[model samples]
Target: MIRKHDSLIHQILAREIPQYVIDERIRNILNFIKFGIESGIPANGKEDEDNNTAETSAFIRQLADDAIVLLKNENSILPLKPEENICLIGPGAVERRTTGGGSASLNSYYHTSVADALKKKLGHDVPFAMGSLIAKNLHDLGEVVTNPKGKGFDVKVYKESFDVPEEKRTLLENYSIDVSNLLLFDYDPKGCENSTYYMQLEGDLTPDKTGEYSFREQCLGTAQLFIDGKLVIDDKTKQGLSSGIFASPISSPQIVNVKLNAGQKYHIKVEFGSGMTFTARKDSAALVTDSASILNFGYIFHKTDEEYIEEAVELAKKSDKVILCVGTSLDYESEGFDRSEMKLPGNQEELVSAVLKVNKNVIIVNQSGTPVSLPWIDNVPAFMQAWFNGMEAGNAIADVLYGDVNPSGKLPLSYPKRVEDNPAFLTFKSNNGQCVYGEDVFAGWKFYEKRKIAPLFPFGFGLSYTDFTIDNIATKLDGENLEATVDVTNTGKVTGKEVVQLYVVPPKTTTAVDRPLKELKGFAKVELKAGEKKTVKIEVPYKYAASYFDVDANQWHAEKGEYGVLVGDSSSSEKFLESTFTLEKDELWSGL
Candidate 1:
């Protein structure tokens, strides 16, 4: 870092420069950067000799315990007895996917696996079976490439597509690049900021088996793969962002299956697009960064599907409670791409069905950033949604399973029974290069309620080991706000927390503008001991209960009408208490 400029006032004494040239903003920025470098903030990691200190680890694990959501529990089947026979069955049990794939992945200094967590909690060795392998059958292109240096495929960057004439094409760069997996990130092509560019990767593939070779492609913008002059993977469509923050692909890969001879040399070519004609894709709201295009490609095969299913069934029959950890990985569901389907990947559905036949005491723990279709949902007795819980995922889960903690986290969004049932289903896909939000106000829970479509699980739904009841709802007008109070009582035999949600149901307006059935106004999370009672008072501004976005006037206006204050645990659940309030005048307001 540069030393502070030898006193500015002293510089004027030597007449080196004029005083008017001083810029306070530039001076402040330089000072800040210099301070950061001199302070050694980047080297602060050295302060902690052991990254996973007991104190810090316990804090993070508690955070996970607080965040995990329990979607379903029938007859209090959770909080398993310490003496119960427990056997882990599934690839997820031992796979130890602490975080989803892609950029979110971390080399956690200390991480716990689900199998290990269970054993630690129970103080006994946990038996685990590799019921069905969650293996990707694709051949690693790194090992197959013919580069003498043993790096990556030969790559060529072009200003035009492969269809362009070779003589007219402008070559950018050509180099040998190697990849362990198919993800491509952080390649900066000069003069290509917020513009479209094409890339061709030349490689050779030698299959290990003489069977139908299938390839899948998932891209941020668009890409196509050709195998020996024939197009095997065509992903030219404008893709949606799978993740909002990371700009992941919203769609899964489209498969192309063909028979090929084993150990035969096959030429591979890939064509990628970075931008879509200056337009945004409809499936995603996030913008695609010109930074790098993540092109993930892989092959698929399941030679021993029957054998795997049989082994899982045998284990399910022997176990008293089956904790089926099934869901998508970061590779399947990430920030860049939205999933093409809601169904679980590979043969997970088949495995679940076969296991259900032999055992009814299955507790399905579905893990994903988003919802997935559960065709076997009805067959299971208990279900939980354990989102990406970081390094303490297993330990946090064991806390809920063993009664160390009660699950209180609610669903932030509705879980549709099928992807087709989503309100934006018909218009969710990008048309050309744009997505239209035609659903308007009817998004998420509002759409389901408006269309009378029942979701598998409604927004704000969660189960606790102990039960709670709400009563004694009362309301009053306090200046420009409505203050509502409700009494929440824990009636069960154990201590737990209950989220009291306050919903506002506006009266049918005399005007023609249609309104949603109800909107979530506020909520309060109350914790209590068994038989404990507490009053939670929530404040809802009059604007929240009476206002609507006036598109014609470009402002939010409130109507003078009667509004019903409905309180409940979730959107679809029965209202615990209902009270009405009246707005004396129509009010218009804006700004947050």
Candidate 2:
């Protein structure tokens, strides 16, 4: 709560600001903070929670309940009134941490894995039993290699220093690694941006300047290294980070050293590759990069299709309703990692299909950064998407499922049927040393309009248990900002929440780029009791609303034209209130 400007502690330290007022506000905020933290978990007797993440021990139970979709609730076994004899099977039935990964990945303070949560929820009412582990031991490989220039890229020889460029000051002038205080050592020369270099230690080394340097003999850089006279590593040559985004040695602790040359200074050299990465060593040679590095750290630990599927089947058979949790994990899609194939992993699809066959009533939940192929969509009765939610995932998911909170999330990207259908697939994994943005700037839903391909699940697709209706949409445009007022009512018997979404469709003109027929600009989550009615306000931007970059204009641009204001539960439904208006003169700034 203490923004830079409102930091009372800062103000008091910088200037002798009064302490009385600051002390009082501290008490108030601290009290709230304390309550918030305590409330996340079940309060011994508190009414509700107010923490950074809406989590509590009950959160696990809540998520399991809300997330557990009733794909098949035959004969009222669920809400498990007289909950029948259950045979909960599957290793996963007991522990399900989460789906998806990356920066969004978080560790819950405490978790009730699917099995633990179910057992806690159903207890003796449903007999809990364990199934076989999906996988006994799983490992994924990750590798990185560095070698001497011109000697070819191989897992041998590592040169520690690099050659300095004649034209520029030595790049190593002031580089420092914090190994210890008062013992800073100089690194090799500078590196070129967007360039790659390779270096090699021909073989073993006799310290050139050894009196004071901490020299140890260890095998590395295709050669043995010796500082002064100590051996740090032995027998191995070159080594580097293997696999994953953490390719640097900071995350890799192992190294190898080669045989040592008894009495000579090992000279370092560098070899540079144009338009690639750069490496340099010992003011003598350029560094060389290993072949492509494979990063599968996350996938290494994932359960196999057979393992996960087997687990799911067992879990499904034991419950009144089978909540089969599955989705695209981090390894499936990433920013730098190019996907080799667009189809769902063979085992993943097989797993879901197999689970569906065993459980007549099955709920399929998917997690992905972007959309993935869902060939089993038609087989599953219910679908829930829990995107990369933050630390509050366990509790948040629980809230929505138990009717404590309503599901109001909507997809922001289109889910394609196949990868081959994408416009970027042709040049995506290119080796020409260049990335060709062949599709210009039109991406996501916009590209679909250009290619005339319908997505398996359109952007803005999400379902709600309760029904809602949109009535009377009125548009109020003020140059760049557009405000909309619409009346919404819960038409179903149960209470629910709905997202008020706004979309803009630019006119098809010579200058207008092929854009999505409609794009999500802004949205609001609104809740209503059954038969309850309320008018909600939403806003949209004109030219300033272009969030996806457009390169041609060197600026973000939205064309001045009539725009649509849509209010509905999802993109596919026609059950909405909409109106149109034109931007005749005023223009929103180029947010490019």
Candidate 3:
């Protein structure tokens, strides 16, 4: 390949480029090729083997259990009793989103959904309802569709356009695909790698319930869905832009609803054109090129968001307690794109409000990697942040919900009540190809503290099954190092863990430079038994504890002042144990 593109490479690199740089680049590429040759590829079957072991599973479960943050436990509704009739509700309850999308996505060997895990622990199935549809696109048809051999679609490739008659089209290859979400960027047909092609996917979709079924189609190129020889959705000519695959501007998803009977099979056919046949103007922002095509086809028994919420409310009314599992998944939260808003997707907020009206014993468990605004937060009795925690997410969440594991996680960042409260709200997006960092150093809790704006939940805030107290705060300074020690005790009957946070409050500056009210310098997590006290010491260099980058001086400056050391479980000011230590002189340094 290098030899083939030799002239083109030379044409690009011959001018203005240093010879040594080009030689180094070539050497690096050769070394990478050599490494690949020496390593060799694994055996076909071994390459995809499941690598998870029993110990690793247990460890993962433990990590998930500890990472859960109990944001609110009003009236102590947590540590749920086993006898309570618990009802699991929402899309997250049934869907196993073990990871995010894009590069972070993976095909785990096995995963247990929250509904399944809870059912197993209760030794019986609980009343469950999908309160809302959080998925941006339609659900895949893999589970409901099948072919003569088994579950899957029979796919065929042709070196012709969809406009051509089936009899006149030249067939290139045919295969069976079990998944409807197909990414064929690297797919090369026997004789059609460099030519335009089309694909046809055929399967039998058997419905489990009689209802209005909705079918949705989205693709990188043009596509159309046909049910029993009837064209249902035409996504070819009337294409709009959408953030679907790779956060690219692909053809917007088109949907069509059809009535179907329970236990009855319907013929499903999808005609897909290659990326080259895309009708819409090619978008440079699209991560996928026109080498191949991408297709996502899905169908589901239709139900209105209101109807789903009503069903969930009915279930919640009868149950002694409710576990409202809700949050963004890979579809709405991923690497390729940023969420348009901070609210939960779909009518989830309405679902939460409706459920809360009927059940006060609801424990809302949100699973997401980032913070989402909760409008009904004040009314809920209990809330927990259970992030997308790998394969053992369900099992670990069940453990925490049932008191088998006490949550010890703290909020790493502040949760703003609204998107408008965010520090970067004004200049968050690009303005004519340039983005301004308007917030500057006032990011995270720093902005909230400096601006005197109270966040929904401050940084380092978390609730434990047991209570803890931090007292007897003392500070000492030795040279450039400052150490703060505090006594943390578990006051409640249950054993729990406490994170002792040490925040440094810089003295009022004499110059024009502004500083935050306080900044977290160091922290220590301590496990304490009931009535047990432990002296946790957190030490930090004075420069790191109270330094700000002096951009003009090209150095970090620690102002000479009496720095206040505040020790607390959270960043909230009211919970702190304060003390003071003087730096005596200003210090400026560059390298770390």
Candidate 3, poorest ten consecutive residues by summed lDDT = 1-10
Per-residue lDDT of candidate 2, residues 375-488 (tens digit): 777766655665534333444443443445556556676778888777687777557768787766567766876667887766666666667888888887776577778888
Q: Which run of 10 residues does model 2 get worst, by summed lDDT?
A: 176-185
Q: For residues 1-592, write the lDDT of model 3, one tens digit per residue.
A: 1122444467567675577777999899999878877787643434444557898789888888888899999888999988987889988888867888766777675777888898889899888999999775567776458988777888889988778898998999887777677766656576775536889999998787898988888887789888899998999868887755554557877888899999888899999987767777465335454464678888777999889999999999999999999999988777657778998988999999999999888899999988997999988999999989889999988988998888899999998999999999999999998989998888888999888899999899999899888889889987768989888889999888888899988786536477777889999989999999999999998889878899888899878888788888889947789899887787789888
Clashes of each: 22, 69, 0
Q: Estimate each model's TM-score.
A: 0.69, 0.57, 0.84
lDDT of each: 0.75, 0.47, 0.83
Q: Candidate 3's error at 71, in angstroms? A: 1.1
On TM-score, the candidate that comes out on top is 3
The CA-based lDDT of model 2 is what?
0.47
lDDT-wise, the better of 1 and 3 is 3
Angstrom error at residue 567, model 1: 0.7
Worst 10 residues of 1 by lDDT: 276-285
Question: Candidate 1 residues 1-592, lDDT tens each?
Answer: 1112344557667777566556765798899989989986794343444667889889989888877788878787898998887677766675555677656675565567688999888888776655565534243454456544454578778877667986888888777765424454455566554456677777877677788766766665577788887987767744434432354333345667878788887777777765442123543224344343556665644346787678778877788888888877766766545678888887888888888898888888777888999987887888988887878888888899888998888888999999999888899888998999989989898999999999999998989999899999999889878899999999999999898998888776637477788889889888999999999999878787678888887778888888888898998776658898988787778864
